[model samples]
Target: MLYVMILAIIVLVYVLTRLYFLKREIKRTTRQLNELNKNATAKKIDISYFDRDFEKLAKEINNQIDLTKKAKAEKRSTENELKQAISYISHDIRTPMTTILGYIQFLESDEITPEMRKEYISIVKNGARRLKILLEDFFELSIIEQADYPMKIEMIKLNQLILEVLLGFYEEFNKRNLEPTIKIPDNDIVLRADHSAVKRVIENLVVNAIRYSSGTVTIQLEEFNTSVQLTISNSVDQLSEQDLNHMFDRFYKADQTRTGKGTGLGLPIAKSLMGKMNGRLTAEQMENQLFMKCEWGN
Candidate 1:
């Protein structure tokens, strides 16, 4: 009977100690939760002692907390982008609208000569044309970024297609006396992609080069064992690292102050189309030249 009593006392002490630990753990978790709620801190709950069920609960809570924080961060980022888009849209649209309106007002003056009148009309027309291009680009970008954008896939001959695109601009180049040097391998590079999308990408690249070139532009097509590359480069006197970095970003005019031409959406649209076709588009600046490169796997 004495031995039995000693064993029973020892068992009771163990039970009491375990209960005390469980209670202390619960209190700690509760306090931590209260602090988190009060301060919005990104902290996980701490349990002083381990219990299988309690540990699992803490793990689940931590996971949920992480998820919630991630969601909040993403929401904030999206909100900021939306705000920027709104500002850019307002500024760009307002510029052309103001020009068109101001020119139309100039057209109303009766003392202007016939040549001046004709010039003002042409200016108004150009402003309207620019506005149209801007709106179309914005609309097209939205469509291309959609997940369900439809593209007809086929084998595209890069050599022929690129030549066709460049030829399309031959007249303009001749007028400006800025014809670019072209280099391509005799062997053809056939890539399985959306032909229309590829043509658009190439067109944007060529137009970008011509628009920014000082007096020279170069177009080159090369093929590797496993990949094909297209490089378009032009001389630039005032290009900066910041310009290179944001060259692919939407509404990123190299020098936002220079307002002569370019919708600033061409490169962004090309990048989007390239991404959809499993291709890569990148820009590099070297000394006084800027190169835009597009690569695709064979």
Candidate 2:
């Protein structure tokens, strides 16, 4: 009977020792968790627990901490982007508005001749048209971002479609003194995409080329093993790598000074539309030349 009682005491002591360690580990982990939650300066959760279960719980809590930090970073990035977009929009609107106002004031001048009056009126009209186009692009971007916006994707012969878009821009090209060298496959290059979306992408690229090109514009279509790349190459007097990098960013202008008249939303919208179509739009700069490439996956 004495031996049995001693055995019982030993068992109880072992269990109580384990319980004591378990409670200590739990307390330490709780303290670490509370510290992490309260202090933004706490970069990581630090705890040493002998219990495997407590260690696992610490790891899970750390994962949550990491997720929270990442979410906060993303929120800050979005806020900065929103601020930049607002600044760009205001600058863009103000430029054309200032021009319109100046032209109107000139029209009221007493010494203005008939030819001068006609020129002032024409300038005002152009400024109004530019403002209208910018507003429309903003609206179109919103539509594209809508989750439930219906898209009609079908098998489109991209080569033929590109030709049609180029033809439509013939007058604009002539006005810009740019006769693009176009190379396309005689064979039908068919892909599944939205017709209107593809057309808009091509048109935006062509317009961008016309606006920024210095010497010649060469547009080419080539098929790779898994995708087709449409490249628009143009010569520029000067362009930086930074410009190439942010060219597709919303409201990012190569000429940040706002000397160039562009809404700066064209490339961003085109990029977003391409993403919706499971494609990509990228840019590169080579020896005073800029190339905008649109890739469509097969």
Candidate 3:
């Protein structure tokens, strides 16, 4: 009878011991969670225990925490980009509007000769055109970003498309006094892409090259086994490495002090369109020459 009683006591003691440890571990996990609430950082929970359930729970909790962190990071980045866009829009719009207003004031004055009045009228018209372009590009970028852009994907003959785009810019090229050297493959290099998007990208790159380049602009097209590359190179004035890095950033200027007459939306819009078409746009600066490359998968 006494041995039986002793055995019952031993069993009770074993159960009590396990219950105590289980409660302690639960409390520890709860405390960690409370601490996480206090501190903004939702760190992973670590606990040493002899159970697979606790380990699995900890891992799942860690995954959720990681997701939370990622969400926070994305939110912060979006907020920053929004702030940047607003500032750039204000500066870009105000500059041209101010120029137009000033030119109008000059036109109102009676002291100006006809030649001077004609020049001022031309400047005012140009300013108005620039403002219109700026607003159009801004809206286009928003449409591309919001996935509202309509695309018709088809087989594209790159050489022919590039030729057509360049020919359209003949007057601009002549105005800039730039003689572009064109090297395209004799054989057709075809890519499956959106025709309008491809054309827009080519046009943007050409416009950038002609506007910023001084003497010679070189445009080359190369085909790889699996991809095609269109590169436009030109000699630019005072283009730095930092400028190249942010060349695709909207409203970025190589020389911020200059306040260029360009809307600064060309490269950014090109980049966004390329991304939508599953292509890549990259740029590099060698010495004073800037090379803009667009790669499309065949």
Candidate 4:
């Protein structure tokens, strides 16, 4: 009986040890599974952060593209506005000009009084001339805005050409009771350019000087190695800075309401012609006078 009891106790001890080892293994496996879950969650968070950064970069790129598009749209809008304004002015001026011409032609008949005939004839001639100038300006402006206008260039004497233009205006200058003073080099100054276009530009400048000068108009010709400059200056009362800024803009009249007769296109046309010829036209105010300067290059 004693041997049987001892054997039973040993068996009990072995069973208890086996149960403790089984419980320890179960706890270790649970801890390993929890660590694996934590590692997987950390990797997911890193992927989420990368996704947010990528979205932010994409948004920035889209914003830049939108800004560029807006700028281009604004530029096109401004160009369209300029074209519309020119069209409106051209259409509005023609009707009045035609009526003035018709009346002048009617006054030439025998029904007009003899004493008033000369004065009527002068008025008609001036009106017709002014209308012609306006039409010419409209045509030239159209050509300048075109992309396919031809530029016929040649080598010509700039100095002699200027002198010829000034001589043509001699009678007008005398009639205005204004003295003409010129400063030119003794030798001929040659330039590679479109001669006809340059002649028109110089003529416009000189005529503008005559129209605006109170007493005297001065012209100077200066030659450089690669370019030539012609300056025409006329004395006038002080002009506002606003006039100086927009002197070459089309249909911009400084004294539009005043009695002085001008279509306000002479300087603008001259400036456009110069641009077509790859030259430049600019204006300056000095000593209470206005100066128009033209520069041509080889």
Candidate 5:
């Protein structure tokens, strides 16, 4: 009986030793697995096993990347085409316009009836002015579209500059039978801007107001702690939401059928000029009126 019991004890000890080594081996394998996972993550490897789901996801990602690349290429091509079209159109229009102006000058030099001469003179003047406006708009658009243009900024008195621009338009206001009410502070309000660009912005707004307004247009200047706002309000027929939204877009005319003569680039040029000067131009519609605002930082 003693011999049997000693054999049993020896067997039990052997079983316990085997279990201890087995547990150690398991711990080592687990540590190695964790280290492999860390290395894979650090290297940004797609260590996922190949499955139907993974294949589908990779296909989707590739398609999205290809789509984005195609869209960018198409956009660049469209812009290039637009630039070429503008160049061709401007050149073609100038030839006939110049010829018309020359013919009108010859007619004026020759002896003619007063009525015929006056009519021809009016037509010539209008045509010349239209051609000039078109050329100016074309040049402005090219400048704005160029990637590199020097933006020289300086501090300018906002109210004084606006006054100067309005003074230049006084005769136009009188001719149109419209009244301009200007409200400006006595003290000068200074804003950091490009003077030429800012002046063009105000001039465009004033001209637009005169073109659309029926009787009176009001100009107001207000200075805040960090910005200055110049608002030009004009009384006009109610405008649709669509017109308000595209008021500053290139070649956008509010009245489709009411055309006399314009390049339809005034507001767009003004907006682009304002952007170059680090300013903003916006329009607001109210009851029977439209308010165009040009704001600049102090």
Candidate 6:
């Protein structure tokens, strides 16, 4: 009878101890839950409970909360980008449209001379061209940003494409009074890319060079271990580091203070298209030259 009483007392103490711990964990979890509900930006769930099950529950809750925060951050970033896109579109189109309208009004004046009328007509035509370029760039960028956009990737002759793009700009280069030196390897440097996209990227780079070149332009191609590099460089007297950094930014104008002749979307479109083709476009402004580089895997 004495031994039976001793064992019964030990069993009762163990049961009470378990009950006390369980109750304490429940109370602590309830308080944490209340605190979590009250704090909008609390990033963690603080649990002091010494139970495995409760710890597991808290960890799962924290995991879910972290996922939610990540999703919210992504949504915010996307929203900001869309807002910037809209603002850029509005400003770019508006300025050119206003110019066209003003020129039209000038042409319609009652006592305009033939010379003045011809000049106004030419101005209107130029404005229309600018508007068209801006709209086309905006369209291409939108297509690139779509989540399900597909690229028809294939092997392309990188050197041949660069030569072709440069030759196509011969007339424009002549008009700008700029002579570009082209250097490509005798052997074909082939790369895996979308042919049309690659052509467009090179064309954009050449056009940018022509637009900003002060004296001469240089186009060079070289091969690396796993990729090929194409660089188009031009002399520029007054380009800052900030300008070089934001060169590929959407609708970033180096001369934002003045109404310049670039759509400001060329480099950005080129960069985005390169990314789609598993490549990259970058720019660097050295002492008196701006180098535009395109790198793609072989």
For candidate 1, the clash count comes to 0
**Whole-model lDDT, candidate 5?**
0.77
In model 4, state the lDDT of residue 262.
68
lDDT of each: 0.89, 0.87, 0.87, 0.75, 0.77, 0.84
- lDDT (tens digit, per residue) of candidate 1 on 1-298: 9999999999999999999999888888888888887876658887769889989999988888788779989999889877876788778888888998998888899988999999999988888898899899999999999999998889989999999999999987886689799998888889989999999999999998888888899999999998899999999979888889889877778877536577888999999999999999999988898999999988
Candidate 3 C-alpha lDDT tens digits along 1-298 = 9999999999999999878887888888888988887884466788866668878888888788788879999999889877887888898888889999999999999999999999999999988898898899999888887766788999989999999999999898888887889999889888899999999999999988888886889999999988899999999778777888889887776777436857778899999989988999999888788899999887
Q: What is the C-alpha RMSD of each candidate to the true structure, in Å?
A: 3.1, 2.3, 3.0, 18.1, 12.1, 3.4
lDDT per residue as tens, model 4, 62-130: 465467668879889779758855764655466546656677776768797876777766766776776
Please give the TM-score that candidate 2 achieves against the real structure: 0.90
lDDT score, candidate 5, position 76: 97
Per-residue C-alpha lDDT of model 5 across residues 1-298, encoded as one tens digit per residue: 9999999999989888766765564465445446645664222113133446544654664566567668979999879767854654465466548767776776867677788787777777777776777777878877886768667688888889999999999899999998899999999998888888888889989999998887779999999998889999999886889999978765566875323446667888888888887788899988888999988877
Order candidates by TM-score, high to low: 2, 3, 1, 6, 5, 4
The candidate that achieves the highest lDDT relative to the unseen native structure: 1
TM-score of every model versus the real structure = 0.85, 0.90, 0.86, 0.67, 0.68, 0.82
Decide which is better by TM-score, 3 or 6. 3
Q: Provide the clash count, candidate 6.
A: 0
Clashing residue pairs for model 3: none
Residue clash pairs of candidate 6: none
Model 5: runs farther than 4 Å from truth? 1-114
TM-score: model 4 vs. ground truth = 0.67
Tell me which residue pairs clash in candidate 2: none
Q: Which stretches of candidate 2 lie over 4 Å from their true place?
A: 1-11, 106-112
User: Backbone collision count in every prediction?
Assistant: 0, 0, 0, 0, 0, 0
Output the lDDT of residue 218, model 1.
Answer: 95
